[model samples]
Target: MNHIPSLNDIKEVHERIKPFIHHTPVLSSASINELAGCEIYFKCENFQKIGAFKARGGMNAVLSLSKEEQEKGITTHSSGNHAQAIALAAKTVGTKAYIVMPSNAPIIKKNGVKALNGEIIECEPTLEARESTVQQVIDRTGATFIHPFNNYDVIAGQATATLELIEEVPNLQVVMAPVGGGGLLSGTALATHYLLPEAEIISGEPEGAADAILSFKSGKIEKAPYIKTIADGLMTNLGDKTLEIIRMYVKDIILVSDEEIIAAMRLIWERLKIVIEPSCAVPFAALLKQKERFAGKKVGIILTGGNVDLGKLPF
Candidate 1:
């Protein structure tokens, strides 16, 4: 039976990765609420290991493999976060990690992978280059490919973050996350389904890179040919598995312009006194832009990652 992940599946992931991951704290800013006219709770995955929530999915993907598969090691292509994730996951499991990164990937992220001892393979930034390069790595090493957002184990792992979020802050009326490849958002939809059944699952997508919103409207999965945004982490197109779950469970997808996203990022930095990447700010941008719609509601926003290059602050 092919379907969305069950509650128990996500629960198991939560328990399995408990020792390796953080039970990240939920923080809120009254200034944000005054500005948005809602009670907003931020599940700050910025504080998670590897500086992002990708750790949960990546760790789960690696650990879920049979001992035989684990011995073969793991490989993945990521611009940043997932690369470090798999590298760390492999390290924890005592296996090799072959990380494929784009030539133009941020220095901060590339250095993080190196610090974790993952072998780095640089390639052209195009999707084709990434896929082909990863395939070559897999063929040469026989390593299992852990897709950034498409694998079942990874999706279940991503769900554990939201499961923790809802459990910590019960009675959320709306839950939102930035939608890129849909791993986090899809997993988030599953969390809302089981934990906060009355909560509406929403997505925040960049206006310049709104593939998820387009797919939701067209009733099918679609690709974005020229996605350009400050939110680099949210630029990837949605995968089929993620799209299926998103279409079935997500209630709405909101589009926020680059200007709005940058503004929201600044607000969070100044108000919360925390560092978050531009991609992490997409959901808050959605909430800020649509203040009236979410007024008087309890909203949970997943700050997906905090892997930003300090040298390139958009403000």
Candidate 2:
């Protein structure tokens, strides 16, 4: 697997997706700064197209394809954001998208996919079931697979967010993002290491889905037996390439509980006026829960996505 993505690769992706995607703003709060005791600069990826950072990777992957490949279309399995990103990107490129999603996926995300005119294949929630269903779709349609997190182009595209973040805030001392399959974390680590060499790259994971944390500690890829948390987007085993990047650049992994995540969500909603999902709240939760470690430091946090269903607020 290709684990390394050079600065040039990230630079190319920055150019490819710039016209289509927003350079989502970075936000800060003196109030939240008072609570967390750190100078936090939040990269508002939650405000991005498709309401997630996945748009960068998805758009880059779709746009990189040749005209012939576009004619054949694309396929992938995702819980939400990736599906919407690919669906929207394919539509922009005048191509078709076949997305396999778990039956349990949020209704808002499924609707977002349909809104982009992407065909949906509903399957059971297990990884095996999702992969099997996607395989059948691929075998029948011959659409190129756009992996959610594991592909080289996908990782490179995701890295562009950190590229912009670091460029905008060059003095950042520490950078952090929530890790699921490690796509965002991998890309962030690669870009930060290359662009801001002295910055510490960290990842926040839900206590229920802390595979990346365990993997970092044990020096091996790990997976939780079952994930039980409101942060649906952060529930997955770390991919092989992602693990390699984590080993190379990520300084540490921190765990946040569901309660802490809810508190963080409320803090963002009340203070930042951002409607981020539980997955996006993990990093803030880590900072709030572990205040001593980050006190007075210049911290960068990726508010990864804001695709939560308004009606389903767990408050």
Candidate 3:
């Protein structure tokens, strides 16, 4: 628990946060399977609390805090889903949440945090600004910082999604997720390593915000060459903790174009009748991009979130 999370750490976190989080379902589409040339199982975290899998990690992180820490409240920097997640989690634990968000974050996500009673402090849309803003909030309010994807507790909580998936649909040949700061991908890798050791753990990353694939290849955290992705939730680069776990366990990180991501997103909406954000579509897009490699395989893909801005949907 102190270092990288073990399988027991993830299981324990799941039990601790279960009351506050939904056991999101595993869904599949025969049409999608036919198209992808693989039997695909989707972990539908779009239906999760706060409408994203971030609910699991955010709840676990807040609930894991000590009484003294809880009294001081919690704070974090996030683009959207994680911000709402921390807000909802703080509310559940009867404490205040101070969220530091970029000025350009979606209005829907901003409203979501407000609905949960989280105090929002907007800053310039950059990582340095976000960190400095969070530090300022911490200094003024004495709130503990809960990183969205970097901390071990958050990673353990994220791992529970994959654990649940494998539990529901065992014997998957490959398991995949989209990489942003690598929280969910690292967690997915860990869960697959522990439970389904034989299963290959892969990830899809936006070619626009394409740092993870480079980091995976270089064995160190790297920034994207340029950032201009419709997948707003995936613009951030990998953190040290997440990068370490991802490098240790993940098999591959595939790159997908915005066009491909949109196509995949539309297919999910049409075939599965589920709404997924662009980042959520990246993994499926990767699968479709390289269908021949995984032909006739059983694959499990974690649909990370469904928090897209309705008016700004690409397709």
Candidate 4:
């Protein structure tokens, strides 16, 4: 479990989480294909439990815990989706969840965590503050801290998304996702490496909070030059574990702007008739940005989540 997940590891994670999560549908739009000039299959994690792919990793991480660890309960720091995932997972396992969330996290996400009965501790909107807050919570409650993206168990769990993707739509020529702290991207890269060895794994990153792309090139975990993006879920920098896997397996990380993200978000709403947050639209935006590169190829895009603040609509 400490090493990078093998094909068997991902399959086991899928089976472990199957009862707790949705086998979210793989959707396609003919018009989207015409626009991107590629045959695109969208893994709609928006319809997933907790309305994001974070559920997969959260459930797997919590479920993998020993009975002693489960009794101590689990804690994590997340902007929104991961918080909800941890809360729901903890609830399912009959344990408490301590969620350290940023003060600036969208109200919708905060409410989702509350609805799941997570104890919320608000902190300043920075990684430093988040770590400090989570540490304090662990100190006070003796809870086991679950890192949002940096842990192997979480990465293995995230890999199940791509595992299911290739199982349903085999032999995709290109697979894409949005890079945040690189959990989903690294997981996607690893799963594609195991199952579809010939498929090129690409990821979209926010141009504003653009650290993963820099890390991908530099071969180390690097910080963003500045942090500003509509993709709140993607603002964090990459972790060391995630960086190592990403550098080894991922092919490219494409950068997309807020404008392009919004445009892509709107396109999915109009064409696919599905609600997706700005971050979920990133990989599709990346595909649109470089249509010629993926032209006429079979592409699978991981629509990571749908947790947008309805009141603060970017469109």
Candidate 5:
């Protein structure tokens, strides 16, 4: 099992990555407020560099390496955003990056990796295959492997977004984020529990990739035999460290269906004039689908990323 990042670790990550990351703006909507009966604040991480919040963690992990380790380069397996984040971060730090991605990864993400001058290794869409391919690249190039959401440094880095959000919206009563490998949720839980102890830290999971939901309910880790969702970003299973943090600090994990995700995506696009991927829309889907439960509260939802293939818009 991997080491879990604590609040102090997150604070260090924030300090290290602060100069490299954007404290993305938070947007509010009276329209959404009326619907959910809550004052809704959306942290627009979609506006972040690399079109996602992954850049913070990517930069932190890459920059933290020793000069010799950095000279060997960095490697990771990602569907899209994380690959681009690592690629761009490596470029910023004067190093190289090798990304392992599934053959079925979105073209926008694949191209983004290439655009950043990162080498790409295409593999089958299974977890085992992704890991094996990443290891092969690491062994061949001697590149440092940066696990997408499992590493303590990576999770701590991802938590910085929540830290900024809470600081900006001090009155927030509840916070929600999309969960996949649970890195962001774990980091967010740690930060929110420390800063806003009264805040309810909730996780939004795609019904297609609701392993976290099942894990929370079963009081143990669980896996979906196969991921089936348009929300490609949320298809990953929870990591051991992430599950431990979620069990300790997360208030609940809510599941949203593909249809609900689509509806929320469309709604955000039409109303907020913001483009969010299916994974980023899951939290909104939960707010809309579970209105009775989330109503009459001050909710902060992290809009995790916006790297969508415009040509593949399901709407």
Candidate 6:
């Protein structure tokens, strides 16, 4: 598959994932906008199937696989959302999924994976450990590996959400998403480039997991330190493919503190009356961090997920 997705490829991805994923709403709040001093449109992927946008890429990767490969099964590693994405996608495609999750991953996410019949392999909460465990599973089961955010097909699948957002609300000056692995942001950049070329693609990242910001500036891949943040889903570092795409397409990446993330998340829940995970609030935190830059601008924010364990509410 081409690393670069054409407009047609993005359209096809929408069609492919349409039956399996929800075209989540583009929401806005007068109160939140008044507070942030910007016209912010939220692409609520919190409402997506599996309660996250990863369902698009994960399902697309599964559907893009050959029948022979699908028969063998699908495998991936995720701290939370993508594990459930692959599991749900595999179930939809009539294939088995093997997920390597961090031993410390949220029990809600673990239960989500198991409920979809995905076989879970718990590994230490580190990219190195997850990669090693995934390799072991691949070797044992001869399964096709569907990387959560690195593969071309997966990125293409991720693009559809942005595509739908642009269609719903065109003339957006900037589109932003919480960047973890770059799959969703990369896809978003492509969609904005083709559908709304005037739009700028911005990425929001946790300061604790600011590898993407470092990599974008340094022109190389960088790993995040082992700092614990509420945004568990964004803890993993970026991949080579994702890094390259972000370097080319993304205009800027802003980092926010964990405290800001929690506050932004609380604001969203209170104002929007929706459940958004901490990872999802990073973009709004970015906007708040730099309110002058986005003042009076029509900004689109992708709420990345809603799968928070109620037992562990940060607020």
How do the predictions measure up, each by TM-score? Answer: 0.97, 0.96, 0.97, 0.97, 0.94, 0.95
lDDT of 5 at 296: 86
lDDT of 1 by residue, 173-261 (tens): 99999999999999999989988888899889998898888888787778764678999888888888998899989999999999999
TM-score of 1: 0.97
- Candidate 6: stretches off by over 4 Å: 124-129
Error of 4 at 151 (Å): 0.6
The per-model lDDT (C-alpha) reads: 0.91, 0.90, 0.91, 0.92, 0.86, 0.89
Which digits, one per residue and each the tens of the lDDT, describe model 6 over residues 1-315?
Answer: 665888999898889889888989999999999999989999999999989899999988899889999999999988678888999989998889999998998787788899999999999988799999999999999998887788899999989998889899979999998888889988988898898888889988988887888889988888775556788888767888888888888999998999999999999999999998899999999999999999999999888888888888997
Q: Is candidate 3 or candidate 6 better by TM-score?
A: 3
Error of 4 at 295 (Å): 0.9
Q: Write the per-residue lDDT of candidate 3 for residues 147-168, one digit (tens) a residue.
A: 8899898899999999999999
Ten-residue stretch with the least lDDT total in model 2? 1-10
Question: How far out, in Å, is residue 37 in model 4?
Answer: 1.2
Q: For residue 261, what is the lDDT in candidate 5?
A: 92
Candidate 2 structure lDDT: 0.90
Per-residue lDDT of model 4, residues 1-315, tens digit only = 688888888889999999999999999999988888889999999999999999999999999999999999899988778899999999999999999988988777788888998888999998899999999988888899998899888999999999989999977999999999899998999999998899999999999999999999999889999999999889888999999999999999999999999999999999999999899999999999999999999999999988777888986
